[model samples]
Target: MPYRISRLGLVEIRSLDLDRDLDYYLNVLGLQLTAREGKTAYLKGWDERHAYSFALTESDRAGMVRMAFRTVDPEDLDYYEKRLKDFGIKYDIIPEDYRRGRALRFTAPSGHTVELYNEMDYTGNVLPTVNPGPWPEGLRGIAPPRLDHTLVTAPEPGKAIEFFQTVLEFRLSEMLVAPDGTIIAAWLWQRPAPHDLAIVPGKPGGFHHAAFVVDSADALFRAADILAMHKARIDYGPGRHGITRGTTIYFFDPSGNRLETFGGYTAYQMDPDSRAIRWTQDQIGPAVFYYSQELNETFLSVYT
Candidate 1:
């Protein structure tokens, strides 16, 4: 099948304390605020070309509202619509918004809202395309370059994995399976950086973390310093992950939503003959946190 989805485009998350969470996102994480309407604020990385890749909305609770993926072309949306119809999946057509075009929205088998779109209003990057420096000046905090993948929780991850693989055409990159062949966790991707989405066993519709991309291992450590300076809740380490081999540090926003700054993962090409790397449940600790070789109780239990 032709690759329909191009890459992860945007994620909208709810915040219990918008002002407090927004402060952390702006000063500590260094996301550029693009626009605001009512209780919602839209933001993007300094290097993102789209109008916004992250949206924070005021709410009484914290969790993800939806995640969107950009399609390869406008026609791909129509193609997927047909496939969805054939599969008896229900969806809605969302009209154009401030900086985004029409979107097709649906709830995944995991109960997470998902959107697919082909057009977004281009606002350009922080630097000029003609003659740009390595980075923009006045950069604060960690200042990651772009948004990375997201991890969510599902009661039946195997079914969710099947939906993404068979319906959305995402390739499984890696997975953690029980001894009896049940899926504990699975990583699926359309783009090159290991996983665009990952699913773990938890409450349906649970939000784990949305990761941002830093440049290197040094940058990952720098992120730790910045998080400490801002007094953000550091959930886990400036450590390595055996799954993607990425350097990472997990932290929480003021609203208690988990976030991560990650780097150094090997790019995954969609090779037809390639099979997903597997990790048995006995090795779950190393599969998730390479440095500790153990799972923290909070890491698996806590989610927005």
Candidate 2:
């Protein structure tokens, strides 16, 4: 690999009522409202080191605008530009503060916009750098530390996997393969976690859900309380997933876009010799919902 993607970075979201979503994200999700520049409102978790890790843009419909990741090396942007060009993908270089300091935004094989950039405005985690405690005081609802991963729907999971694996250097963590060995869903990551991104089978350009990782299973239960208090729509979860063995809850934001609060997965570590874990399509339901041992139609069909 020419370079490495350090972690999942900012996610740009499109919402029907930006203010309504902003209120939910800030008050219910416990993210801080960092700034409102132009039509986009930015939010960051209390523990995020970046200025803001979430962006909400008002739109006619609710969905994802794009997802981004940071690079291990700041100069990796130029290296990615070359790699994308060699692969015949058109891309643009966005300069400072457009999204962050500088970025390379491009369309991926999955028909979703993706950005790669190493620069972001560093905003401290609101704790002293020396002897910081486990958490900050007065933290609000759901209050996850940072973004863990996101799942997007794509027409061709295999193609998307190829782009992620070969171009961006994401390694496969797990996947669901059909009887004929066609990959229908896949989890990929460059980090130590199980996944930073997952491609699920659906219409091209669809976004399934973005998951924010909490510290434990108890956090998911608490998140359920907050969602119920606000009368938020929860699609699935307060259940554990056999796939990653992580506890999760799938709920809808005010805009009807699905959001997941999750935590506690079996740790995954990889080496050059590592291989992906696979599941047959017959086991899909239980793979996703460990307790249910079956997937609900809504879970399989819903996407923004």
TM-score of candidate 2 versus the correct structure, residues matched by position: 0.95
Query: How high a TM-score does candidate 1 get?
Result: 0.97
Q: Which candidate achieves the best lDDT against the true structure?
A: 1
In candidate 2, what are the lDDT values of residues 1-304, reduced to their tens digit?
4337878888888989988888899889888888887779988778888888788899999899999998888877778888888888888888876547788889889999999999887768878889999888888887888888889988887999889888887888889999999888999978777888999988888889888877665677789999889888989868878787778889998888888886744444555556888988999888899899998988769989
- Tens-digit lDDT track for model 1 on 1-304? 5677878899899999888888889999989999888899999899999899999999999999999999988999898888889899999999987678999899999999999998999889999999799889998888888998899999999999999998888998899999998878899988766888999998989999999998676787889999998888999998878888877889999999999887844333556556899999999899889999999888889999
lDDT of each: 0.88, 0.84
Clashing pairs in 1: none
Error of 1 at 119 (Å): 0.8
